[model samples]
Target: MLKNIFMLFISQGVNYLVPLILVPYLVRTLGAESYGEFNLALSIILYGCLFIDFGFNLYTTGEISKTENKEKIRHLYTVTIASKFLIFFPVALIIIFTVNNVSQFDNIKSVCYILIIQMLSSVISTVWLYQGLEKIRIYSLVNVVVKLLMLPMIFTLVRDTNDINILATIQSVSFLLSALLLITIAKRYDIYLVKINFSDIRSILSSASHIFTGTISVSLYTMSTPIILGLVNTAFEVGQFSATDKIRGAFISIFLILSNVIYPRINKLKVDNEFLAFRFIKKITMIQFFLGLTFATAIYYSAPYIVINYLGSEFQESIDLLRLMSPMVILVPLSVILSNYVLLTWNYKKYYLCVPLITCIFHFSYIIPLSHYYGAIGSGIGILITEFISFSLLLIFSLKSGMLRKIYES
Candidate 1:
């Protein structure tokens, strides 16, 4: 577990560090508006990648972990390829139409086009295969190398504001290279790319649909905010929201390293000693909460200093927005427990499906209005509210359904 966490930390550090380092540079060079345009295009690429992924991370990875039959593994590999190509055509068309038809995206249409590399690479990279096989070192090595390569490319090429397209292209190609590496290395598994019949494809998609919806719903809420802000407000406001969110999101991601380490562990634990795992989880929950509280307090008090010092004077308005979102740090770890551990451990997989739907409901009902009226600050407030609501909903639903009791009774 320590080895896995350490490896993940190295890879995740590279992933998180590059973007945070670029924020101040990009903000100063591109200014808020253009930087936000880059963010918006990136968001679209995110959802496009999400569509191609279709919950294969959890569903397919879980499937791969469940069995060792090479025939079955080969079949899973073939169907995954088939399913992604099946999903990709329509998604590409949608991307084409969205950039051409969507007025907000008119300026960065080139960025969107270049990001097709990113979208396609997301499907082909197959990090999930390593995670499933528990050969996590390979996954960590690939991500870290690509991220390091991207650092030099970004610094060399993205010297000016007009280079957002170049920056996007560099990032996309890094992903493509990573995918190519994965494809090359994957042959070690002796997996062959065979033709999957339509029935095989249908059964794969059918079994995976709920997981897919949950993934899409998650992308819709978390990744859609910047895009929605673009539709509702100017790109500058998206800059304000995204600037602070980048920091907050990165920190939350770092804290939840436990999630990746513990999740598959729980898969093993539940089989042998679920009661012990439940008790262990109680300790983890407390640790997460206190860590969250500490970060929240620090952000609330010091956002101004951090923003002004790290982000420069141009991002002063983000101080308030950052503070508004501070509490989110507190809820993230708890949410991870509910969503990643509890739901998966207790044979309540369907419960996991419903949480993101509720999050979407809160998005449309509360977040959109708040974003429309109050801009980024409103969006921050809505995030706080929805996060609390999600935490509450998951707890309440578990208790009501006796999943909570099952944990204690174990």
Candidate 2:
């Protein structure tokens, strides 16, 4: 598990740093307007990626971890892949129609279109397979190497605002290449692709539908932030929010990497011994909570310095937004542990779905007003509010479910 954590950190470092390094460059070269446009397009593409994923990362990982049969694993992989492909058509159409028709997307329609390749790449990823198998070194290596390779190309090709399309194209191509490489490496694991009928695809999709809903609702509150900010505020505010959000994202990514490392292992342990799994979750949760609090303090205190050093004086507005949203570093990981590791893994899917469903509703209710009145700062506060609501709901549900009580009593 520690080894997996280390490998993920290495890979995720590349994932986070590319953006961390490029954001200032992109912001400086492309100007706030174009950079904001790029972020808006990227946010829209991320929604497509999330839909294409359809919670396969969690659902399939749990399934694969619990089984030792190579054939079963292969069939699971095939069905999940096929389901994504099947879902892709409708999602693609919705994305295309929305991009072409929506007045907000008019400025970046071409960029959005080119970024559809990222959604396709998400469909092709085999990272979940290696993660489930607890042999993620290859996946991590491939991701790190491919993402690193894209840095030079981006630096070389992206020189002006008009090159925004070229930037999107380059990013999509790198993602596609990484996915294909992962698929090829996955075949070597003996989990090669197999032919599956429509029923097989439907079965996996049906099985994972609850998880899909939770993921989508989660995305609604998380991914929709910048989108809402873009629509309600100006491009410069969006750029500021995006920059600060990326900094907060850097903090959030650490906890998520830990969650990813532990998720399958917890599922595997739960299959053998539920109490043991609960204990594992308990220990990890405390550790994550501590780390999260420490991060929150660091971000809260260091926001001004970070913003000035990383994003420059032009983005000074992002300082307060970064500080305001800093607590999300704590809320998000704890919520993940409670929701994914505790509720969903234990088949408390109703509670799992309810947490995000309710929070997303709360999110949409206030996000518009907040963005409208206070712009980036308001959006930041709105996100923090929703995350707190999610964390509160998850904690309440987890405690009331009696599992945590049982762990204590045992």
Instruction: Give the count of colliding residue pairs in each prediction.
Output: 0, 0
State which candidate has the highest lDDT. 2
Please, what is the whole-model Cα lDDT of each candidate in the order they appear?
0.82, 0.89
If scored against the real structure, what TM-score would every candidate get? Answer: 0.94, 0.98
What digit string (tens of lDDT, one per residue) describes model 2 on residues 1-410?
A: 78888888898888898989998888888988888898999999899889989989999988988889999999998988888888888998999999888798899899999999998998888878888888877788998998899999999999998999999999999989999998988877787888878888888889889999999999998898889988888878888888888889988988887667799999988888888887888788789889999999999999899988888899988889898988899999988888998899889989999988999999999999999899989998999999999999998998899877865654
RMSD of each: 1.9, 1.2
Best by TM-score: 2
Q: Candidate 1: lDDT of 410? A: 52
Flag clash pairs in model 2. none
